[model samples]
Target: MIALHALQYSRATRILWLLADLGQPCTRIDYDRTDAFRAPEELSKVHPLGKSPVIEDNGEMIAESATILRYLVAKFDDDSHTPPRGTVDYWRHEALFDYVEASFAEVALRAIMPAFRGKPVPDDAKAALDIHLNYIAHALGDGPLLFGDTVTLADIQISYIIALLERVGLLAEHPTVAAYWAVLQEQPGYISATRTAGPMVPTA
Candidate 1:
């Protein structure tokens, strides 16, 4: 069985969402953050970085949301969540999965976090966010998901980031992103994870 060290209002929500969508049963171990919004010391015992979304499976532990998602899809997903290996869509899946973190996720995190903490968002930071926002909107295009109606790992990763943008009031400017956010919000798995992750994350 997979065990998730889930942190409320953190990236772990998406990991839970992914698990729910994939129909995989997992033991979710919840953690509370310090008033300062830092992980508790118990988390550090799970991994060196002490981050949420760590998964323990088959006597091995994995950290990082992207890494865990990749591992799960490769090891546990069926054709519904991922295409067969060696096809174009499969490679696209690989690219988008990595791109979510390597590109937008990193930039977006630095952008709205100060605002999330009630600090003013800097002009340069907003500018950087705008660039990625445009890129994300274009990627989302007309469809609600990454590959039309298909819900792949790319959709899971990007949709969670889109949800973050919504929470922080960043989605209004990007209509395409806003539409995609609306679509993901209706998903059963997303709804389940949202409710489960609610108490741990910020209401803001």
Candidate 2:
């Protein structure tokens, strides 16, 4: 069985959600955050970066959210969670999947860092975040998911950042994206993952 090192308020839920959607069973090893809201040192024993969502499968350890997602889909999924390998939609899926953490989440986290430190978010940071949000709004258009009605790994990858934005009420300004998130929240896999591992935002 796969062993998942799940950290509280981390991207591990994305993995859990994917596993749920794939009907895969695994062992979940839980970790709590430090008082500073960082992953505990215990997590370092699992991975050098001490980041959450690390998985052990076939005696191989995997790190990074996008890498793990791709690994799981490639190994366990039967193309239900991804598009055909050589299609235009497949390229779009891969692009958005990578963009989630690299572009969107990076700016979203940057904008929220000051608030986490008990300080005000600077105007420049807020501007950057707004730009990203607008891009998402445009991408979303009038849809339920990032790429039509079917839920793909890209949508799963986007959920963590969506939860973060929702937690801070950033979605209030982006109604389309907010509506999209509402739809995602109702996904059975998301519900199961939340019940098993808790919400995606930190509590400490």
Candidate 3:
């Protein structure tokens, strides 16, 4: 069985959604993230970084949200959560997942960091975020999903960031993102991942 060590309200939620999309059975172990957003010390036992969203499959440990998502897809997706390999859509899936984290999420996070610190988002940061969001909005072009008609991990990956933006009130300014977020909400595990996963308790 897959063992997922999730940090509440973190990217681990993305893994939960990914697992659901893949139709995989896994145990979701939620952890209390500190007010500082750090995972509890116990997570260090699973991965040296002590990060949230670590996973173990058959004794092999995996950390990092995107890595865990891709690993699950490689091992268990079986054409369920993603398109078949070697197709345009499949390659698009790979690029979008990586881009969602490496590019788009980076900007979304910059915006989120200020909110997390209880500070006003600076105009410059907002501008930078706008540039990135516009890029994604354009990349989405005419979309329900990033590629093809069906939902895929790519959508799930990007949608997680979009949800973050929504929570922070940034999503309303972007029409494409709003539309995509609407479509993404209907997918399985979306509510659980984005809203229903709930908050972490203090790990005392």
Candidate 4:
């Protein structure tokens, strides 16, 4: 069994979503930003950094949400359930996943983090956010999803990142992104994770 250290409104939501998508059963240890993730005695049992989204599988611990996703897909997914490898589509999928994970960091720093604190966004950060949004708009190009028409892991990952941006007022200018977000929200796994994660906090 896999044990997931989860937090509300954190990247742990992605892990939960992936598990739901794969129909895999796992245990969740919920934590909050204000709390110490692991008890003092259990500290060594979890990640050294005590971050959420750590997974313990067969006595091997894995941290980082993307790493967990890749591990789950590789270990538990059969051909019909896994993304294709060594192809154009596969590379495109990889690119989108990279973009979402990297781009959301900038978005969070620029928009969501400030909103969570109930503070005004810095002008410089807002400008940077505009550039980020434009990049996503260009990448999207009126597509139903991030990587063409299929609902790949790229779509799943990017959708949650964009949804977090939306909660921070960064999504209003990107109509294509908004449309893609709506479609992704309809996915069963996404819906399940959203319910568990709840709406994004206005601040970090």
RMSD of every prediction = 1.9, 1.5, 3.4, 3.4
Candidate 1 lDDT over residue span 1-204, tens digit each: 999998867888778887888888789998888888888999989988888889999999999888898788778745676666899978877787788888888788886688787787788888899998887677666777867787777777776667766778887788887888788777777788877667224665
RMSD of 1: 1.9
Error of 1 at 48 (Å): 1.1
Least well predicted 10-residue stretch by lDDT in candidate 4: 35-44
Best by TM-score: 2
All candidates: TM-score: 0.90, 0.94, 0.86, 0.83
- lDDT score at residue 88, model 2, on the 0-100 scale: 90
Best by lDDT: 2
RMSD of 2: 1.5
For candidate 4, list the clashing residue pairs, or say none.
115-202, 116-202, 116-203, 117-203
Name model 1 segments beyond 4 Å from true: 199-201
lDDT of 2 by residue, 89-160 (tens): 889888888899878888998877776676787898889998988887787766788777888888899998
Q: Quote model 2's TM-score.
A: 0.94
Question: Model 3 over residues 1-204: C-alpha lDDT tens digits?
Answer: 998888776777778777665666688787786767677888888778888788888889888887777787778635666777889877767877788878887777888778656689888888989998888787677877676467777776776677777777787789887888787777767765555566222212
Ranking by TM-score: 2, 1, 3, 4
TM-score of 4: 0.83
